[model samples]
Target chain A: MTGRTIVITSGKGGVGKTTTTANIGTGLAMRGHQVVVIDTDIGLRNLDVVMGLENRIVYDLVDIIEGKCKMHQGMIRDKNKLELFLIPAAQTRDKNCINPEQMKELCAKLEREFDYVLIDCPAGIEQGFKNAIAAAQEAILVTTPEVSAIRDADRVIGLLESEGLHRPRLIINRIRPGMVKRGDMMDKDDITELLAIDILGMVPADDRLIIATNQGVPVIYDKRAPSGLAFSRIAARIDGEDIPLMDLGPKNGIMDKVKEIMGINRGAYSNA
Target chain B: MRDLIRWVVTRKENTKNAARNRLQMALMRDRMDLSPDIINALKIDLLAVMSQYLVVGDEFQEFGIRRLDESVFLVSNIRVKELPRANAN
Candidate 1:
């Protein structure tokens, strides 16, 4: 089947690009679609560790590109039983080890076999960034609700537009509802206005995400986690569903108590 | 005393408007890359020449000169009631 190549990118580091790629890949695979995630960060590879497939890498992207190994030999299957796979980057090689043409050729080959090919782009607006975007058919920009992150996201959006990638959707990560309610941090609305782009999803700052990542398990498998549900909804949206965004604030009254009584968690009740 | 109070308030408003107008005109001229000093000198020279032709009262109200782009404009808000009409002869 023909596949869509979606690149998960953010200009600022530590804003959850790797986490997003892992979760979205897991969510899409859980929906029974064949998904392959490629880590484009040549030197500083972390997607393998995040996906818990670090020990399984015999050959990497550089090996496949350098004709040392077959493309299928470099692809590592997920520990779970879904049709998910990952092509880990070579930790020893630098960004110059592969170029955009090589990446585009690799993705074009993978697209024919998988339903979704998600690329985990490296931070910065350098050569690594250009290589990642060159092969992407769709782009998802991840950003935190901070001024610096938003500014960098805007700059990234400008660069993407210059490359003829228009109207890239945004994903607001690490939003703390408490801080937003206290007016200490900018909310999603503020970020959306400043960035002026469509929002694919909003992932809350859930502590369980850290625990799952540390345990080499994606949070999307933890159905009880808010961030997990958010990722699932994002995957569903990508599958062409019009699912409404989940309200990630803490519960505060009879409605929450009713949800507690009914055993309803995660987007349990509607405000309207 | 009431008339004096009204005059004071109105005079303050007029001064504020004049200041705002001058600032706007100066900013426009600056953005258009014109020399303000040259424009001011030209306005003074034009006023002097106009005064020799007729009694030019209230220099601030009688005329205003501003530079717009590469051109200059002269605006006059004179009291026509005080001046003799062309058919007065």
Candidate 2:
């Protein structure tokens, strides 16, 4: 019943876990909820950088957990979203610097004060994974359509369930519509069928995402970007909204369309 | 014409489908606290045991993927065959 704590994680690196966390955190805040995004990637902090609050992090999560500073003192509020805040990780500390119990306690404490606590988990299922998942009541798994990413995701989902974190929703990132349409890449349907999990959203490979990350700004603020729209829908879904998944279905190419008009239209590739 | 229809229905090997099937098997094995080779061995053992119980001159089909321990893991089914008893006794 307390504020929901959801850990955003991907067993594979560079699958956009941090980006999803930042965007979803910002999206929730944009809807007027008090949200706190925590960087649990310890030693390799990036949530702060992605959120553009790196310059304002006076104290980090390790400091708060270690009692070196008050919890509130370590939280850096987003300059753009007054309702959204960030608890940056300590780049100087290792995963051992804070244990799972400490992180769980932190979540318990934050639950009383915020609407959502989003933890940006470190890649790989190790001590850092244990620490990041320790406090989460729910989990959001991020992965790409690639074989390596999905393989790691399957492993991570197994790991999550073994830890009693069951039914974590999935986010398929960096999907290329063109590739999927041409059957050259993994489609969302295939990925969902493989993982056998509820897919929260799918973000198309968008150049704007890279730009947003470089500028420490989330694409959700742009509203026009496909990835931004996807994140917004995901945030809404998390909020108990029953919005239908977006239609990124494959489209018929010009040649295919032209063939259909002709009498010689190959009925073979029509369904495809 | 028949070949064209077959080709249409039988979509080419897509990168996505390949990834999906691989992931599905991997996750199932993983959640079961086992590996691919282990599950395959289990399936083989299962067939052997099933054959032991089959009547003479009888046949059976192999089981498909089955859920084990709720969501913990899935037992990979290889093939259903005649009860072992039919062939043995």
Candidate 3:
């Protein structure tokens, strides 16, 4: 069967698009499906580093598009044994290097070979964003619970609707259940109501994600990490598995009370 | 006299509620681009002319024009106090 193309995007920056692309690709590959992640950031490529394949990138998306190399030559295999690959974007070139048509053609070719192709889209609703969405059959919009992020996500949803991309699934990233309970930040219901979209999953704000990214490791390798498990659940959903979302809230515990007393602000509440 | 006072209070409250509702609907419609600026401008001009005829008091409620679908509404409450004969002249 042909692969499904899924573009992971958020109109606002720093909402974990690249991280999600990497982890979901890893998660899907772990399930025995061949997966490839394409970083569409072009001039600002970071997915390679996030996936720990930066040094292995001999050729990039631009090189493949420009006919300097075959498509397979650009795909970097993961450090683990899973059948995951990375097509890093060219850092030297800008977004203008590849247009929507070219991206669509490339994804179409990749889909014939792989079971899943995840595109890590750039920030903003400009040409780069358009290029990423043109090739995908499914879209996963990532956003935090903050007002600004939610507002941008709403705008992005409107744009997607205009482009005929209907019913795109939502991934509310960096949620803090404690903050939602305290009424200090917008909750899942608040975001869902405002955006009026079906939610695929919610990922809590986990610090280990930073360490994992820095170490050139996809967080999905660690089953114990909250963020990693969240991505795995998202992957399962993508693969037609019915997995429940993770309970990110503070359960009954003395440590939870200590965290509240220490004033460890939760997710969106930290800024509010 | 008590009936007259109650009637006046009820009228005032009803007017205020109507004005608030109109403003909210108009604003929402305007945001959705269902109401054009031509109608909004016309509503503003009408409001300005009406203000000159009414003895609108300090407690007068002002509501911003809001758009609701295809309709434009003037959402505000003006206290139309009766002017004395000398003041009217």
Q: Write the per-residue lDDT of candidate 1 for residues B4-81, one digit (tens) a residue.
A: 999877755534234334444543443444466775676678667766555665455544555665456766664322
Q: Model 2: per-residue lDDT, tens digit, A1-272?
A: 37999999999999999999999999999999999999998899999889988888789999999899999999998989999999998998899989999999999999999999999999999999999999999999999888888888888888899899999999988887767777878877788877889988888777778888889899898755667878888999998898887656434677655754773332212111
DockQ of each: 0.03, 0.48, 0.04
| Candidate 1 chain A, run of 10 with poorest lDDT | A263-272
Q: Say which prediction, candidate 2 or candidate 3, comes out ahead on TM-score.
A: 2
The residue ranges of model 2 lying beyond 4 angstroms of the native Cα positions read: A249-272, B1-13, B28-89
Give RMSD to native, each candidate. 12.7, 8.3, 11.4
Lowest lDDT block of 10, candidate 3 chain A: A263-272
Clashes in model 2: which pairs? B51-B83, B51-B84, B52-B84, B54-B83, B56-B86, B60-B80, B60-B81, B61-B80, B62-B79, B62-B80
Please give the clash total of every predicted structure, in order: 0, 10, 7
TM-score of each: 0.73, 0.78, 0.75
* TM-scores of chain A across candidates: 0.94, 0.91, 0.92
As a whole number from 0 to 100, the lDDT of residue A68 in candidate 2 is 94
TM-score, B chain, candidate 1? 0.36
A1-272: candidate 1 lDDT, tens digit per residue: 78999989989998999999999999999999999999999999999999898999999999998989999999999999469999999999899879999999999999999999999999999999999999998999999876667767877887888888888999999887766665556766767765779999998888879999998899999977878878888989998888987565657778776875876655542211
- The C-alpha interface RMSD of every prediction is 15.1, 1.8, 11.2
Model 3 spans with C-alpha error above 4 angstroms: A254-272, B1-89
